[model samples]
Target: MNAVWFVRSRQINRSISWWLAITGYKTSDRSFSNRIYFVYLVIFFAIWGLTVLALVTSTVAEGLQAFDPARPVWLAAQITVVVFLAWWLWSLFEASRRSPIKFTEEDAALICATPAPRPAVAFAWLVSAWFTTGLLFWALAITLGFARAEIAVGGNPTWADAPFYLSAAGQLLLPVILLHLGMLAVVWAFGCLRLNGYHSQGSLNRYPLALGFIFTAGLVFGGFEGIFFQSMAWPASAPVLSGSGLANYLPGNLAGLAWAGLGMGALYLASRRLNLSRAAQETSLSGRLQAASILGDQKLAASIHLKQRLKSGSRPFPLPGRPGALALSWKQILQSVRAFGAGALYNWSIVFALSLAVLLAPNWGVRGVAALFWIAQLHARLTQSLRLDLDQWPLFQALPIRSSYKLLAEIAPPGVLAVLVGWAGIAIASLLAPGINLWGAALLLPLVIFDLACGAAWDVFRQARAELLLAGMAPSPSFLSLVLSGLILILFLLPFIFFNAGLEAVLVALLWGGGACYLLFSLASRSMRKLGK
Candidate 1:
């Protein structure tokens, strides 16, 4: 008993240590510690608070004395809980099977040399697995059971009530069961493939089998439950069927649940068997590899060869230019812009998705949706530009061209892409909402161009600030700088958005902003030239 206690304590300590490591906690005396702790605490509290709020909202909705049958919030909550349970179960099973036992050479040596029992260590690991994985869900189920009981006693049922409740529960449980079956099949197939030595060879013969199992399981169980409930073959007069009329189909639901459980059990057993086989295979391979290395085998040596590659891949075709200062500056700007575009795909995809949705959606929805997409695109462009300015200052200095030109070049591609994409989105909106004049196109095109120019100038100023910070010449931008910049951009774009109000106002604003930006950029270019030298 004492030995068991020690093992349990050790396992608990190890679990805590592992969690800390994964979460990036380290013992350090840094000023940033407070900031890190504050962020962590905020996130933790926010998650817990949200979860509690959801639970309360769900409970209140369920406990209402007079309920609207059409309102589906309670049903949604029940479905959500069941889905959560299914996901929880799937994650737990996956974690338990995949978490490798940390058996070291030292451990093996100790096992051979010491009188200490290995069973204690094994027992502790088994217990840790339970707590780390499924135990949380088990506790959640208990809490949910209590919540359900309270709601059951608190509410008086209408004819639709019992059927609705049962349907809600069934809807939730069916998805969970189906999800579990699908995940179980996937894990089972992967285990089988690993056991069969197909994984190492990269063969995908088992993929179809795995996918088939998943689809078949999910569809069959989900479909059966849907049909059974729809048919309403069960007696409505039955006591269990009194409220929701769902208890009539309880037997079929149970059968489906049982089948899902059986699938999960089969997956678990398959996984265990496969895991044992893999351990044996790995042990055998380790022995063979050790033997080969000891024997000074040429093939083993060849297999272990390492090579160093240059950090940068082959360069693109160069323009016909002297290796002078201007040429070098152009190269740096090009490189930075190229890098920016590489990471812009995700943002661009979002823009495209929103634009397409707006085009396909109703005319009434088009304006609001297009505006949101426009805002999103603008944010992405600005953020990308800002990040580039922050990172590439040294490269900018090393370039042969003037710093201002380099900054302009960096902003040009995205600015152009943004305008084009924005126009395309507007065109889409126009198609959906007939009688909307495309005259805004002329105003918007120039506005986007002017905005881009202004944004580039602002980014250059921010970069200049960053450069100063690096050289200890100036302080970094305060929180106020960020707020002011955001406000300025919004203020600048406000007139452009309201171009339909008056073209003269739009044109005046564009000219004022654009002229100011160009002038600043020209001055910045001269400053950059001097700094670069």
Candidate 2:
């Protein structure tokens, strides 16, 4: 146990040192680069702090306006229930598939070779995993506590006044944090059992899956009952917002915390029975996956994940018998299918959800959120096929096809899919939401197409440059290159900025999108051709 702690401490120190070195810091000497890095970080944090503070202030103000003082308990309970349900389902799914306790390849190798106690190693890894995974949640909870301070004592308070409300905020925050940790403890317990090979045998293998199915069905039925009863307005129907005093809620919260603490205690006792060798074997790929993620090489991480998934007896899609560009398209489409089952349909569903949200939004805030969600999803999905193609650039380049043809073939499947989904989402949203503007809905077709083309073009350019860096031919693209690309995109989108979503805007977008797609495709082809040379 002591040895495990020592190893973990040394690992943490090594990681910190590696990060510092990467950021141009040296323990031996102070240099100009260190100062530059220090200034950059200071400026970055200054900007980030200001932006976060403003956003939190606005969010808190909005929330407090709609907050019901009589139902604080109800709100907290609802949040707790939602978080538990999500974590429960996720834990079951992940444990059924793989071990939740992860180690780096190095750590796994060391633990497997040594006489270290399995329970202590698992506990250490569990804590490390929980902290790493829960950091974002912890941050959000802390921010909420900070924001709640404004309304803590029933007045708008400045930063100096916030301290007065710290007691109230802490009351809210402590339980929330404990609840999250408790949920993670439960998950780790289940994961340890899975890793120890307890759940691998024939009958027990399907036990988790059966439970997951039952849970899903029960959830669906309960939701239906709630909605049905609420809509019928039965006298006994539970109110959506109901609460009691904080004093009444406190006992139940304490009871829940006690239960979780007991579970954690049991987990440590049971960990001694775990199979360290099996655990290490199961998590071998996970270490590589985590290493790739830590190094900011998401593409590498994704590729590793895909390969892992394929190792479960699933083969790649067979190649098309046709030659030239058709073969490239088939390869891209197959890769997409194998990497993400029905991913195109999933993307479509997201776009539809966003579109519906936009139309049904009662305020600019909701609409803005919907738009942001769409943009984030669009950026990721639009480049899916192109990234896959770029990964195997040499194979595609060697094909007996023109560069332009190859580029067109690679982009066509995903680009067309994106435009189709976007258009369908908008059209269906218009039908479902009669209040939306007909002209705006109609004009969105071209705009969506234009957005897809622009996203693909930019992604291709960015990824192609990264490929060059990976191949040792060039350094990564500079800030200037990024600025120039943005300028070019703005120029293309300039005409639509001033016009309303009308016939004129539609015509402009259609022409611009078509021309831009052609030009960008040609540029990509030319750039890619220079790869081998």
Candidate 3:
């Protein structure tokens, strides 16, 4: 096969693998035939059930709602939904085409050497496109039909009475869909062009820096324009072509259609012009300097190397100081707090501040509380990996350390940070909000602390199931963790939600209840020592 044919085949094969894996039909020697068939049956039922559910829910929800002729929000919402649907369809098609498949260098060479018929390859590509595009169109038609039926039934009117509403909805959705498709085409063109440029380079060193600059500039420009745009009102003079029979709307509609056609053409031309064979050449001067510097200052080079190792989460050379085991645990806690990225100690501080904001924000208290809960959950999961550094653990074990000491070490950084930040937030809010007493602020600290402690404990519990928890690091699977965290959050918020009964009474109840639960769990831990290990 030619290069294009080979690439398409590899893409299909990879998609098949992903489909099988998702349906639990492992394509491995250990997979049983019965398990494969069972998985297929389950997937078949799942897809059927989801389709049925969507159809039923959409029908019911639509039937109860009347189409308001005067409300622009409804039209805006419909356009937004249609645009999202189009983007979702495009993303699914692209994801299927880029699935990973392992291949050797020799296999690649052999495939490149083959000379397949271009017409046949093009025919195959067309067939794949037809199926994917057809599915999207079918879905769109079903959705539109369901929406129209719902509006007609709910408003107790015939199609003839409100043909204008249907026309208006269609007019709104068409432009949105076209805009989405145009954006996708632009992105596709950019990716193709970037890949071609990278292939021309023999080395990738400068590419990273170049890409970073491009990303930073894009963010700055995009954010600036977004804020600027949102502040301005839509131009009143812009022609609003609606409800004028489909034929009357056709002129403006055709203009939009023409723009979309131009965008698609540009994308196709960009793809064809992609320079796939170009290779980057390396700079020789930088290579020579690095060799001389290493020889001339061996000591400095070693120190620099040690710093790099530490940055990569490796232990420092010559070992850590001979602190007591508890002291060593404190050091580890401090390290986790100072560490950057997702699990950094600084993020937990933010979470603490947000929690206080939630408690104090007048109208926005509920939303702030929900956001705080999410941030705390995220911090816990992000920091859970710190325990995986076995080298750091040995230093603790070598000294006189108990499991409780280890657990305390794990919990201290997040707990203390959460408390301090939470207190500051409450103090700031109390200063601004009148009628808020000292007792209420004092009560808020314990509640926040308890919630944070529980979150930390759950994270540790998840680490005990390392394999499952690690697998769940991906955002999709992490939903289960989110759900569990949400439950704990509800428990944390219940006392505050009913604080009108008296702050002292609520605090006493929470402290007693939390203390009892903690003692019970601690006692239970003695029996479940294997998990702690």
Candidate 4:
């Protein structure tokens, strides 16, 4: 067997398996208890996924069997699926350009000096892409296929046909796999084009602006319009990917399967034309990012990644005020944009575009929960700014500014933007289905933001305290950061668990929001006292 065969058949599969095993829980080096917990968690999730697949599979199969499919809902589902698939593919393409096919330092040391290294390296790329892209499609198919599942179920209270979704999901799995192979082929071709200087990599980063704008506008506008307008043509015909309407073609036929196979094979051959040294350097970039993540320096990893995407424009924003930490906030906000340009914009657009998903959800409760979850994740990203600032704690203390002003400045812009972004999701949801629940979303989100801002400040403060408190002790598990964030989230959400949306609920939320703000303020001030702020 060739060296590539050995790596692919034995070495790489073991590495991939070991990666999956550890990544779902913790690193391989983590304690036995962590690994055990991770295993239980995986098993539980696996069972839950299978249960869901089972429950819906039969319904899906039945839906597919009908020669004449259901109309508007199905079309909407199809559109959402197509749009999201496009979005995911676009994301993968941008990411690949930023970090094209390459070998790691370890892989290069061990593998690159060998005979015919390019084929092995290319095969490894194809292999990793197979797992990642295949997994992505599996997730999207289940999710998008179930987007309108309730409507499909149609109040049928019977278990007789409830067990077929798994079988159907399994059947669709091949087409899904093929679909991602097609995507990888496209992205890989683009990477090759960039590598050969046929196209600038930065062009891949910039050209997404128009697409992002359309996606954002569609999610915000079409999202509401879809609910109001219902269908362009009610009882619209079912889309066929092969006989296309909105690109829902699945490789259910031999011809389609053959085409998909050929596309992937052709891309692999194309990638084989890549310059090994250049590809090796690109792969090293990926390795550095992965290592940074593994070492718990995600922010640094993100920064390194942005450097590769490499946006232009070093010009500063006009002074927001007389310019104290406002200057810092403005700079950070701009740097996040200018450093990664299209990559950053594309991500933010995706965040807003999720209003489409929110609109598609069956109920306001689902919308509220999803919005809050999105908001919190974005909030956590924003919170990293505080952590970044605290990295130079002595600089902050040495500044001429008062402690309270400094603290407020740190929280203001990003915190407000986080709140605004969260509400955009709600606004779309509300437009689709106007209801009292909007009150809950509108009220609840700001309170959560307030709580998060406080928590982030407190995280910085606690770190400072920890330095003074337990300077000699090693830090706790990585999960503890998540635990801290979750605790803060639960604190804010606690008031929400009992109260239904009403005049009383709104009144209570207002009072709670007010009291929470006051409390957070007091805490922030007290915490600031540590640095004599």
lDDT of each: 0.46, 0.59, 0.45, 0.57
**Which pairs of residues have clashing backbones in candidate 4?**
56-165, 57-164, 57-165, 57-166, 58-164, 58-165, 102-283, 241-249
Each prediction's number of clashing residue pairs:
8, 0, 8, 8
Can you give the lDDT of residue 414 in candidate 2? 60
Candidate 2 lDDT trough over 10 residues, lowest sum: 235-244
Worst 10-residue lDDT window for candidate 3 reads 233-242
Ranking by lDDT: 2, 4, 1, 3
Model 3 quality (TM-score): 0.45
Identify the leading candidate in terms of lDDT: 2
lDDT, candidate 2, 1-533, per-residue tens: 39888888777667767777775666455688777777886698666864575467456545644775654434443443445445655775686566667666777678767888877877777766667766655545445455455545455566776554455445555555565566677666766666663546334347557655654565467642355423432211121111112334455456447645865875676576676677677788888897889998866776788788788675545765466567776666666667665545676688667756756778977876776566556545655555555555555556778766765675566657766776676677777776776554445455444444454444455445545735533223334334444444455446657686556766776677567656665665677566543
* lDDT-superior candidate, 2 or 3: 2
Residue runs of model 2 more than 4 Å from their true location after superposition: 14-93, 133-152, 156-164, 171-183, 197-261, 286-295, 313-320, 340-387, 402-404, 411-530
Candidate 1 residues lying further than 4 Å off, grouped into runs, are 1-151, 154-208, 211-218, 221-345, 349-379, 382-396, 428-445, 448-500, 523-533
Q: Write the per-residue lDDT of candidate 3 for residues 277-379, one digit (tens) a residue.
A: 2201121222233343545653334334434435546545343455654565546545544444442445565575566656565675676565656455545
- Which tens-of-lDDT digit does each residue in 109-180 have in candidate 1? 433244444334433444444444433433333233333433554444445554544344444344334433
At residue 161, give the lDDT of candidate 4. 38
**lDDT for model 4:** 0.57
The estimated TM-scores of all candidates read 0.47, 0.61, 0.45, 0.51
Misplaced by over 4 Å in model 3 are 1-161, 175-183, 197-261, 273-400, 432-436, 439-529
Please list all clashing residue pairs in model 3, or write none if there are none. 199-278, 200-278, 200-279, 200-280, 201-279, 201-280, 202-279, 202-280
Per-residue lDDT for 1-533 in model 4, tens only? Answer: 77666765665666655667655654444788887887887898798886676466446545544523545344444553455346544754574465456567756766655657554566666776667656655764564344334334653525553444344344444455555565566566556655653344666655455545555565567652454223421111122122222334442334335545666676666666566556566678777887788767866687778776664444656546447756666656665555646655665666666645654567877866655555445545555555556655566557776667767776776678767877887787778777636656566777666765765566556556445323222122133444555665555455566674456666766677668777876686578667422
